[model samples]
Target: MTDTSSKPILILGGTGKTGRRLAERLTAKDVPVRIGSRSGSPRFDWEVPATWGLAMQGVGAIYISYYPDIAVPGAAETVGAFARLAVANGVTRLVLLSGRGETEAQRAEEMVKASGADWTILRCAWFSQNFSEGFLVESLLGGEVALPVGNVGEPFIDADDIADAAFVALTEPGHVGQLYELTGPRLLSFADAVAEIAKAAGRDIRYIKVSHDEFAAAMAAHELPPEITWLLNELFTEVLDGRNEALTDGVQRVLGRAPKDFSAYANETAATGIWSN
Candidate 1:
C-alpha cells in the first residue's frame, strides 16, 4: 500500500471556491495539506513554472481547480504539462475540476489521463455560489442582475458537494479513472434563480435579459478589465447556449445522495446576510 499518511495533499487554487472547501474538509480530518496558489506559502502560480516544483514536493495527491476557465486557449497545453510534471515528481493522484460541455476542457482531461497519475475528472456545470460568492455577487447586490442569457436553464451544483466528491476521490479508493459529470438535481433559468434569491432574501431582485453586445458594452462602461470582460462575454455567448441545460446524477453516483436544491441553497445563503447589502 502507498504510504499516504506522510504525504500532503496539494490543492491548486486553494483559496478559491471549491479548493478552499476541500482544504477545510481535509484539515478537519487531519490530512496534511499544501495550498497551491499565488498567495499560498511557497507561492505556486500557474503562470510561473518555477513555483510548481516546490509546491509539488512531498505532495502525494492534488486537487486542481484551474484559475479562469479551462476553455480558454492554451489551457489544455498547460494542464498537460503540469500533469506530466506531477507524475515525474511522484505525485500519485489527481482530481481535476473541469467544465461541462467545454471541448477544450475535455482535451485537458485527456492530458491528465495520459500523464500516468491516478486521476478523477469532475466535469461540472455552473456553480450555485456564483450569486453569493463569485462574479455575479455584485450584480445581485445591485438588485438587478442583467445578463445575455435568454431563458436557458443551468443545473448549478453546490461547491460544497464538489468538495465532498473531491475529498472522496483524493483519499479513497476505486475512483481512479472515473469521469463524473456533476450537476444539481434540476435545472433553473437565470431568471428563476434570481427569483428564488429574491424570495429567500425577502427583497425585490430583478433579472434582465440583454443582447450580448449590450452586456459587453455595459461591462466596458463599468471599467471592468478587458480580460475579465472578454471572458464573461465568451461565457455568456458560447458556454451558456443551452449546451448544459440537462441535469446529471454524478453527485448522487459519487456521494450516494440527492444533490442539494437551489431553493435550499438560496435560503441558506440568504440567511448569511451576504445578499442584504
Candidate 2:
C-alpha cells in the first residue's frame, strides 16, 4: 500500500462508474478514501466551489473524475479551477479520467497539466460498461439496442481495467506526468459488441442503426436530462465517427498486461445478469 501521509485520497465523482470501483480498490488496500459526491459529507458539488476546500483538507492526493463529462462546454475551466485549488491546498497528486479525441477533454487535460501538479491523464476510449451499467441497459433488456453509429470500430475498454490502471497511477511512484491512452485489445463495433453480449447472455438481442434524429427522439421520449440527452446525441454522432477506432497499449504499459477483451467483459458482466431478460 502507498503511504498517504495519514490523509485520505479524495475521489471526485466517487459514486460514478470508475470512481466507485477505484474507491473499492483503494479501501481494500487500506488506503483512506474520501468520497466527493453530492451525498457525501461536506457535499462536493461541481457547480458549488465552496465545498471543494473541505473535501481537499489533509488529502495527500486526489482522483479527478468530472461529472456529466469533461467534453461539455466550460468543463475545462471548471476542472482547471478545481485542479488549481487542489494544488493550492497542498494536494499535488492529481489523476484525471479524460476522454480521447474530444477537443474539450484535451483542453481540460492541458489545464490540469498547467496547474503545476503531478498530474497523470488517462485519455480513454469508450467504456464497455456503457452497455450494461449505463443508458443502454434498458434497451438491451428490451431485446434491441439502437444507436446512430454505423460500422465504426471502437476499442471499448472495461471499467475494471481503468480502475486498475488508476490504482497503479495513484498508489505507485513513477507515474507522475504520464498521459495514458487506454483501450481494449479488440476493435469492436457497437453492433459487434452487442452481439458478444447477446452470445454471452444467451439471449436474442438486436442491434439497430438508427438515424441521428431518431436517436434524439428516442432520448427525448425517455425524458432524460437535457445534458444527458445532448451528451448522448453528441457522442453517437460526432465522437463515434471513427476517431477512436484504433487500440492503444496504455493498459499494458501501466499494468504490464494486455487490456481485458470485450468478449471477456461481456461474459463476466452477463454472469451478473445485467443483460438478462
Candidate 3:
C-alpha cells in the first residue's frame, strides 16, 4: 500500500548478499527494480559520486547496502551525501543496512535520519553467512579459520532475514522511523559455529582462536588489503568482545516469526554443498 507503482526502487550493493536477495524478492512481487552496481546500466559506484545521479534518476525509494560496510572509512560521509542526493532527486523512502555496535555505522544512520526522507534502519549483528558466503569461506576451504574472538558468543543473523526485514521496511507503512536490531534467535561462539558447520557438512573443520596480536599478524602475512585486514582486526578485537551476546525479538517483531537459527542456516547451506569439498 506504499504506492511504489510510480518510481523505480534503487538497490545499492545489488550484487551482494542482502541486496541481491532483496532485488529478487521485490521483482517477484512485480515492484520495479534498478540494480545499483558498477556493472549495471546507469551504474552506481559508491566511490564515484557522479554515478549517483544516474542511479537516482526516477528512483522513489532506495535500499542502501554499502559494500565493505558502513563502518569502513568514508562510508558515513559518502552515505550521508548520497542520502542528501536521493532526497534531492525525489527518493522518499530509504532502508539502510547498518552494523550493530559500530560507532561509524551509527554516524551513517544519523545521516539517514536527518536526510528528511522516511527511513528504517536494520542494525545487524555479524552474519551467519560469514562462514558460508563471506570471509569464512576461504579459511574453511583451507581447513582452518582463525580469529581473535574466543568465548564471546555472537547472535549471528541470517542475511535472508535481513533481506526480509528490509523488504518490509521499504514496502510497509508503519516501519517508518524505526530501527530494528536484527539477530538470530540464539547465540553461538565462533568455535561452536565452526563445529555446527562441520556437523552439517560432514567434514572436519578447525577453528583456531588466537590472541588479537597473532590474528592480526597472520592476516598481514596473508597480504590482505590493508583496509579489510584492519576491519577484521577491529571487528574481532573491539566489536566481538561480548557486546552483542543477548538475543532480540526484532525479527519476530518485524516479520511475525523467530529468526532462523545458526543450526538451520548451517544445515540448509550445507545441503547446497557450499561447505563441501
Candidate 4:
C-alpha cells in the first residue's frame, strides 16, 4: 500500500478557519501539506485557472473550502471545475467542507461526486467561531449582534473539532464515499449563542432580532461587498428558516466522540480574550 501521508495534501482556503486548524493537525502528524490559497507559494486562485495546476502538482489529496462561501452563485460550477481539474491532474482524494441546509452546497457535492475521485463530504452546521473569528466578531465587539432570524436554532460545531475530523478523513482510510453531517451536540438560537458568549466573556453583549430590511440597512451602512451582502441576506432569509435546527451525530461517527458543545466553545474562546475589548 502507498503511504498517502507521505504525499502533499493541497488545502484550498488553507489560511481559513477550518483549513488552518486542519493544517496544524496534519503538520503535527508529519503529513505534508500545500496551502492552496491566493497568498500561498503557488498562488492558487479560484478565479485564475492557471494557478490551480501549479498548486495541485504532486498533491495526493485536496481539501476544498471555497472562498467567501460555497453557497454563492456559480459556486457549484467553480467547485466542480476544480474537482475535475484535480482528478485530471492525477490527484484523486478530496474532502469538502460544506454548509448544511444549502442548495448550492448540495449541488457542489454532486459535482464532486461526479468527478470520479475518492471523496468525503462534510455537510456542516454553522461554525461556533463565527462569533469570535468571523463576521460576527465585529458585532460582538460592537456590543450587539442584530439579525433578521428569530428563534431558529443552529447547531454550531467547533472548528478544532472539524479539523480533527478532516485529519482523520485525509490521513486515515475508509472515509471515502461518506457524507458526514457534522454538527454540535445541541442546538441554540442566535440570541442564545450570544448570551453564552456574554456569560463566558463576562460582558453584557446583546443579541437583537430585527427585520430583514433592517439587517440589510445595517450591512449597507457597514459597506460590505455586494456578494457578501447577498450571502448574508440569503442565509438569514432562506436557509435559516428552521431547516437545520436538528442536531446530528456526525462528529461522533467520524471521530468516535461527541462534538464540542457551543457553551464549551464560548468558554474556551473567551479565555483567548478575543471577545474582550
Per-residue lDDT of model 2, residues 1-277, tens digit only: 2347588889988898999999999999889999999988868999899999998898889999998899988899999999999889888899999999898999999999999989999999999999977888999999999999999999999999999999999899989999999999999999999999999999999999999889888888999999998888778878998989898999999999999999999999999998876
Q: How many backbone clashes does candidate 3 have?
A: 0
Residue runs of model 1 more than 4 Å from their true location after superposition: 1-3
lDDT of 1 by residue, 1-277 (tens): 2235988899999999999999999999899998999999989999998988898898888888887778887789899889999999888688899998887899999999999988899999899998898988988889999999988999989999999999888887889889999999889999999999999999999999998888988998889877678778878988999999898889988889999899999999999999997
Per-model TM-score, in order, reads 0.97, 0.98, 0.97, 0.98
Off by over 4 Å in 4: 1-5
Candidate 3 has its poorest 10 consecutive residues by lDDT at: 1-10
RMSD (Cα, Å) for all candidates, in order, is 1.2, 1.2, 1.1, 1.0
TM-score of 2: 0.98
Candidate order by lDDT, decreasing, is: 4, 2, 1, 3
User: Per TM-score, what order, best first?
Assistant: 4, 2, 1, 3
For candidate 3, write residues 218-274 as lDDT tens digits: 887889998899789789877888888989888998999999999999999999998
Q: Cα miss at 52, model 3 (Å)?
A: 0.5
Clashing pairs in 3: none
Residue 210's lDDT in candidate 1: 95
Q: What lDDT tens digits, residue by residue, belong to model 4 across residues 1-277? A: 1136468888899999999999999888788888999999889999998888899998889999998899998999999999999899888889999999899999999999999989999999999988888999988988999999899989999999889989899988889999999999988999999999999999999999999989999999999999999999999999999999899989999999999999899999999999899
Candidate 3 lDDT: 0.88
| Worst 10 contiguous positions by lDDT, candidate 2 | 1-10
